[model samples]
Target: MELEKKKIVEHNDLIMSSAKMDTVPLKFFELAVSEIDTFNPPKDNTIYLSKRDMFKFLNAKDNDNDKYHRFKQAISKMQKQAFFEIREEKGKGFVFRNIVPIPYVEWKSYSDEVKIRFDVEIMPYLTELKTNFTQFALTDIQGLNSKHSIIIYKWLNMNYNQFEYYKKNGNRDGQQLYNLCNPIIEVDELRWLTNTQKEYVGRFTNFEIYVIKKPIKEINKYTRFNVSYDKIREGRKITKIQFHISLKGEKTIENSSSKPKKVVTLADAQQSPYSQLLIGAFLLQISDVQDEKLMLSLAAKIYPKYDEFVEKYSLDILKKHLEYVKAHSTNIKDLVTYLDNALENYQKRLVGQEKDNKESKPKNRKKGVIQKEKIPDYISNPGKNKLTQKGIEDSKAADELLAKINGDLK
Candidate 1:
């Protein structure tokens, strides 16, 4: 598929604020907004996208059932999540205004399309762009696998471009070699932005592992900037995060004109001969399947041991080991220890099975023939909790209350 140019403009305040969104919905929003006529947004403020175009943009499967389900799910999430707009007051400190980007999303089973209307309140920030607005190409973020990476890339790009503009206009000091903009954000604020505060609360290590490290790595790898951060602590506790941003190369103008040379997907990786082993390594490192950073780090760690693991175990066996660990382990605090334990358990089970097979063989059987019984498929995921309809509604209600409480506290 040929990559298309999609551009979005937002106020710097909104760009710099805390907004939590999922990968799919965020991508949909970008695609939808790109369709809007920026100069003259429809008077009704509604944006439309056909089912075909949405699927194309997402690089999703063409199967109707899967596409429709995913589309609705993304819309539901976007409707529920709130975006915080940061504002500076004259007398008071910074204030946060809660705004939902799209208040209404409508789709019908009979129709082959979707409709999303920008909330009237959020229109001004999105539409007019005389000043204090950041414009970025959507293609620059297409390669990103996480929402946080996309957000950070945009934030850094905005600031970096502005820094360059200022320097060229003589607004910046002539002696300045490189632009260094440090945005000091509270810990809670960062969590809110990444949508992991609730899941990672009281566990900064998990947050660091999932939110901070991985996204920075992805941004540095896929985008045009190099990002790093310094933790600002408060007497042994990390209270704030100061992100240090700079362009990747010596080129002042960020270029995103060319398409990605290769686009790798999980499905493509799984089909490769060596990728199965890599996937097994990933499963070992993943504390939460949703955390992409852990998966990436796992692959990096297991690269040296690939041959050793491949020689000892087949891909199917390694996958079984992963499934067993995922189903049995409740919490993974240390990934290294967990992987070691998992490997030990796999070896023990293999030895036990071999012994049982040897004992069961008939006395008249061939001298060196070893009959190995096939391992059965895991029939159930015992540890997996199924969410009921009521439970889902209750959870959403609770999230709304929590968001309100957070807003009030601010």
Candidate 2:
């Protein structure tokens, strides 16, 4: 089925605005947002959305009576709800503004499309966003099953995007680094944004269990980053939240361009042995190298170069490149040789792509207009590896080398 453009960008303020919604309505709202042309939204403010598209986007069975009923109910809920409240500073105080996203909904009996109009007042927030915007792929949250999950994903993604932008721009000052790298939000404010204030009010543990934990788990499982949070307590009561977000399989490198330095401290050396085992398991699972003995034997050979792989590309990217190799090559006699060739080809492709992008850009374009490099989706997780390890044994030499490697990282 043909899909609408797979991405949407909204002002960060709007994304971080407070909203209370159920799963279906939130999904519907996202579908409408996806249809919006953020750069040049239609002057009419009314957008026609296909029911078939909604069903497909939600992965629901189309033409089912119960599903259709739920869809209609969601639309009704959206129309009656104040879905967004934009807060801005006034001269002496603050002013709170609200918008009913779908002011009107029109549908005909037995029709496959629904017509809805956006509030004209909401236009400024949705269009002409030059800075402080959150851009994400629609597919990223389509599979999410909770409204809280969707909200948390967008919030975390906005922070991730900000972190990347600051890192790219060389904003390394201590205060700027802290602000950009760590997004510490008030617990009550987060509750307002996620619409859990009433349900989990004054009960941090319950809130964490029902609202925070599940969404973080789902976001990490289905999206690009692994998310965890630390609570800040005031007088034995939680008052703020500090989220720790990181892309899986890639060491959080300080400098974007510099090669990842090896661990150089005793404390850093502790992770080396674990890293080797994880990499070995990842290789075995992805390559379908059946013989545990053979896999361990080859892993031993590849162990010394583990840092090289981590330094050059993320584990996810390497896995994708390897999968590409597996799909394209008909004969793979030697697993080690095949892996080596795959890694080489992958690097070559990246270099070529970067060259092509630069050449395609206008030579006389404005200075400092750097094209943002898109980070690839999280393709696989090392922890998810299900390789059989009946006969495999750790190599003492590999362990020693990895310990040295870890120490070098410091």
- Identify the leading candidate in terms of lDDT: 2
CA-lDDT, candidates in order: 0.63, 0.67
lDDT of 2 at 88: 74
- Candidate 2 at 204: error in angstroms? 1.7
| Candidate 2 Cα outliers beyond 4 Å, as residue runs | 1-5, 172-175, 252-410
lDDT of 1 by residue, 1-410 (tens): 23355677777877776666778888787777777766888768898777777787777766656877787788888888745455545565766677777878787778867788888877777887789888777677777888888777777777776766776776554323243244456777677666665776676887887778888899888777777887766434787776766666644322253211122333222233443332333332222332445444444444324446547666555654555565566777866457766676666767776677688876776643232433223322224645556545644654564444334323
- Extract clashing residue pairs from model 1: none
Residue 209 accuracy (lDDT) in model 2? 82
Give a tens-digit lDDT track for model 2, residues 1-410: 25645687788888888776688888888878777887668768888888779888878874566877887788889888647877777999878888887788898879987888888887777786988889998888887898888988888889888778877787565445544445677888888898776797665678898778998888888887777777765434677777777888754434544332221222222233433443333333322332445455444544456447656655555444544454466755776776666666666667776677688876776633232333212322345543234312223433454455455444
RMSD of each: 24.2, 22.2
> Deviation in angstroms for 335 in model 1?
50
TM-score of each: 0.54, 0.59
